[model samples]
Target: MTFRIGSGYDVHALVHDVSRKLILGGVTVPFDKVLRGHSDADVLVHSVCDAILGAAGLGDIGRHFPDSDPLYKDISSLILLKRCANILNEAGYAIENIDTTVFAQAPKLEPYKDEMSHKIASTIEISPESVNVKATTTEGLGFEGRGEGIAAHAVVLIRKISKKSG
Candidate 1:
């Protein structure tokens, strides 16, 4: 059996756009501000996608979903995650585990961790237990602490499945 590990991190600036809701891990969290980006800006999902792609040696998210593309405008990161899973499947890789951390200063995320895990697991077609999502604050230390942006980090482990001897 072969295993690969990949780590990813992403951050998006917070904007005062009430029209745009704050989305993380495919769940909308109640917040006054939202992250600004080309896509829906679900930071957690973006990081997770990057981690999965990295594990498969497929480069980063930008390589697959370039921001320059008009088709991905305002696209959902969850969709990107699903596409990533398909990419992994094509490469004969299966998700073993995914661990992630979200950084923010407001709108406490503790309540949404479980849902995030389940959503990610569902998207990847893996057991919910294989996904773990954690939230933390910077203690007023960095951009996330200053409430200027939201960030997430993800580390994923993937296993190459063996083909049956027909």
Candidate 2:
């Protein structure tokens, strides 16, 4: 059996719009500013997707879901995460576990960590115990701390599925 580990990081600027929900790992985190991106811009999910692809020896998110593609216009990032899992499964890789952290100074996320974990696990067709979502602040030091943007980091472990168990 072969195992691989990969990590990904993502950041998006917060826009002035209040209409868009601040989604992280498919869970809505209420905030006045929404992330700016071609997609729904769930930074946590995006980071996880990248991590999965990385572990699978696939290219990054931009290679799979380009911003220039209209097919992904304003699409939910959870959907993208699902696709990533499918890709890995088709490549004979199984998800071992995923850990992630969201960097934000506002709209405290301690309460939503469990829900985020559940959402991410469901999206990838994995057990909730295999997913861990955490949140932190930069102590008002950077763009995330200053409330200008949000960021997330994710690490994933994937193992090649043995033919007997696959």
> Which one wins on TM-score?
1
Which TM-score value belongs to model 2? 0.95
Off by over 4 Å in 2: 162-166
Query: Which of the numbered candidates is closest to the native, going by highest lDDT?
Result: 1
Question: What is the clash tally of candidate 1?
Answer: 0
Report RMSD for candidate 1: 2.3
Tens-digit per-residue lDDT, 1-166, candidate 2: 7999989999999888766878888988877888999999999999999999999789999999999999999899999999999888888899999999999998699999999999999888899999999999999998988999999999999999854233
Error of 2 at 131 (Å): 0.4
Model 1 C-alpha lDDT per residue in residues 91-156, reported as the tens digit of each score = 888899999999998869999999999999998899999999999999998999999999999999
Q: In model 2, which residue pairs have backbone atoms overlapping below 3 Å?
A: none
